[model samples]
Target: MPLSLYLLAVAVFAMGTSEFMLAGLLPAIAPDLDVTVGAAGTLTSAFAIGLVVGAPLTAVLARALPGRWSLLGSLLLFTAAHAAGAVAPDLPVLLATRVVAALAYAGFLAVALTTAAALVPADRKGRALAVLLSGTTAATVAGVPAGAALGSALGWRAVFWAVAALCLPAALGILTGVPARRTPQDAAERPAVRAEFAQLRNPRLMAVMLLAALVNAATFAGFTYLAPVVTGTAGLEESWVPVVLVLFGAGSFTGVTAAGRLSDRHPGPVLATGGALLLLGWPALALLAHRPAALLALVFVQGALSFAVGSTLVTRVLYEAAAAPTLAGACATAALNLGAATGPLAAATTLDTPAGDLGPFWLSTLLALSALLLAAPLHPALRGTGRTDAPG
Candidate 1:
């Protein structure tokens, strides 16, 4: 609702763009660098690994920096990394640059969410977080497509250059728009990070984090290899790949919007229903993958259900954190990156089997169910607590 929230959204849009553009550019980058496609694809994996390592490390190390400062600094780091990637002469150099970019991405998200929480009334926390996350949805709609087009037209490095340009403006915008405030570690602040960690000893928060990771693993397992699935398994033409992906993006946008509204009213129910839907969606969609109409319908529904997980996941993690939401938010981000890295890697290994398409679906189904099952322990803790708060 606030103009500042929209600016934060734009900053996140830039970060998401840089993070996701690699998928489209991998072919171009591989050929240009004289490397195998699989090797070039490791750039994306490198970024995820960096994110997994950086999220908590940065949050802990930068605890003394103002939220506004932390966000701006992280964006600046993102810009620099993009610039480095654009100019790198070798594959190893480019891969290193990606790690830098991902660390910034992971760290910036932690700071951004903390800033969102501090920016509004407690009742609007869900909405504020939604506004921040809309950037990722927007990337699915706008950023990834634009990056793909740019890479196709000008070359993959050009895409990195474009991302760098976007990052500069975003970094500056954040520095200008966000108000200066005391650091989280200031004397005025409540419970330290250690205290937050202690409170996080709760089974509920831990279960939610695991669930979030597993849910993400399930989705990414299918999505990372989607081109193969659609063309080989679903029998769709290669040209249809982009079309289906665009539809998935549209579905993600739809889900994010609806989830934000529902979360404001009933966070637990929305998440519970979404998790169940997502668990059901994998098998249903896999079975229908060969039917054009059914596949299309399932694809859209799966996109919606898969993305809605974040709305509830963020809220639950923060609620469980009580007064020290930063650590919980950071930990959740780390868990998310862990899944992002693991899903594709694990799926790649499994999909090489004789069953091919069936492998990913079965693996994803198991992961999704495991993720949903984590909700059992968390259910009782959430009982009777409102969406914004939980007992410590």
Candidate 2:
């Protein structure tokens, strides 16, 4: 892997910290923001909405710019958004900042994934993408827990400030390390809105995007409420939540690394296996929520499975949309964020019901099962040509 790949990972770590740290801080944020926990949770959805809207929009806007310049612009905007979030005066202000930050985050990720794949051989594309995604796993392990701890001790505002500080180095890394290069095709193929829109008509590509969305919905539905689930249902103290998150992150890191190596060879089987794991794991977690040891184990397992599916989802989209790799990457990001936005909104509705905390797990199980069913058709489409080059 090139140093640029790792630099992209650094940018992702900063963005991922901002994206996920809010989950752990929801409890603290609710009281300070004068809203219910469910309402505070909308912040996650708001960020997702930004991603849904921003990914393709940024793709269009930055298509004419150099990759390095595009990344730097997004990171600069992202860092400023975090700073604004740190000093937000009310819920609306804070939510606005989240939307802004997510826009930049989504754009950076789309560009980074495309750039990472471009830097490596076709055979190693999956691993290259995985290296970029490892930044998110690392953020979940280190950044999220630290944000949680900071929120517990200082306040949630401090966490935003910390995220802003982290982005400086990430921006500098991109500025110094990432090269400015475009493939011959990249230069010749100018941005065309109608052409990009037409790509959506491809059934296989659409199915891959839907699969990505479903997988994220399943994962985020349960995960958005993990702090409360662990403390209220799993019988753990608030302090232990970060520890469990670390464990989950560790599993995610392992899963992504493993999936990266396998997805290039067996994308279909890997996708099927991940979906099956989620279908099994979420239900088990729901049934065993009262048991702390079992709950802990299940969380780790679910995290691993969720991320394995994620890695494969990206790989499949890239493989199927090889001709429009950047736009396809943007579409994948948008699809996942759409699911991310919907998952917590659905979970919030469920929280208001009699089922309460356990509702999310069941919701996640259903989503995973839906994803599994979708995978059935995808295997045939991917059959012998899973490794074929996209038309340039």
Candidate 3:
């Protein structure tokens, strides 16, 4: 709720926009870089892979850096990467720049969580994380669209330049407005981090994460192929792509806010409800793809459900891993990126068949259903795991 929290969102917005802008720009980039579209597509996976590798690595290495300084440093890296990406002369250089930027992306998120959690009360931690993360969700709506337009009108390079511009101000905000807090250099949060991992290793926690991962895999797998699905299955024109994305983004923005608010009140109900929405929404989305209006509606619902669950899941992780909150937060970001990469690969493989795009959606639906089942059982475990290690 603080202005500082929105400043955190500024960082997330730039990161999210830069990460996803490549998706819309791949068609243009392939020609400019003299590579195949498939080759250009590698940038998305490259960024996610970087995130997966960087999240924990940043956590461990940045252990000695102050959260504020670390965040500022990461933003600087992100800005430099975006600038290099904009001016990249070849495919290899572009890909490398993306990876470099992605490292900053992962580090920024990891430290941002650390910074955000330190600003709020223990019980309010979940809400605090949600507020910070809402920027990412909002990027789905605002940043992605903006990037897509820039890519369409100006050039792919222009999109990167635009993203770079965002970084300077966000850096300034963190440097000025975001109050500094000190944390241990050795990961004093390590014990709590271990405890949180132990909690995740718990059967209930494992089940919940598995469910989330699977559902996530499903949603992304189908989602990765959404444009083709819409074109082939729904008979929609390519021009309608932005419209569809806008619909989903709107849903994401709404869902992220609602989940954050609800989790702050009753995380259990919020998690359970969001999980259930995914279970039902995926099937509806899959079945409805052929009908443009129907598919649009399903996309909206699916976005909301997926993001709502996301908000609740992060909150739950923070609650359960209260002591090692930063590590927990970093792990969550890592897992989500892992899903982003894996889900699309799985969907790409499945959609390669003649069965068309709906198959991935159906698969995602099943995964989401499993997650829904796990949400209720693990809801209580999250509450129990909070603050067990705090000083008496």
Q: What is the C-alpha lDDT of each candidate?
A: 0.74, 0.85, 0.72
**Which window of ten consecutive residues has the lowest lDDT sum in model 3?**
383-392
**Which prediction has more favorable lDDT, 2 or 3?**
2
Error of 3 at 217 (Å): 2.7
What's the TM-score of every candidate structure? 0.89, 0.96, 0.87
TM-score, candidate number 1: 0.89
lDDT of 1 by residue, 169-195 (tens): 777677778877775455466567788
What lDDT does model 1 reach? Answer: 0.74
Residue 248, candidate 2: Cα error in Å is 1.4
Q: List the residue pairs that clash in candidate 3.
A: 218-364
lDDT of 2 by residue, 203-236 (tens): 8888878888888988888888888888898878
RMSD of 3: 3.5
Which 10 successive residues of model 2 have the least lDDT summed? Answer: 383-392
- Give per-residue CA lDDT, model 3, range 324-363, as digits (tens): 5557667666767776666666555555566666777877
Order by TM-score, highest first: 2, 1, 3
What does the lDDT come to for candidate 2? 0.85
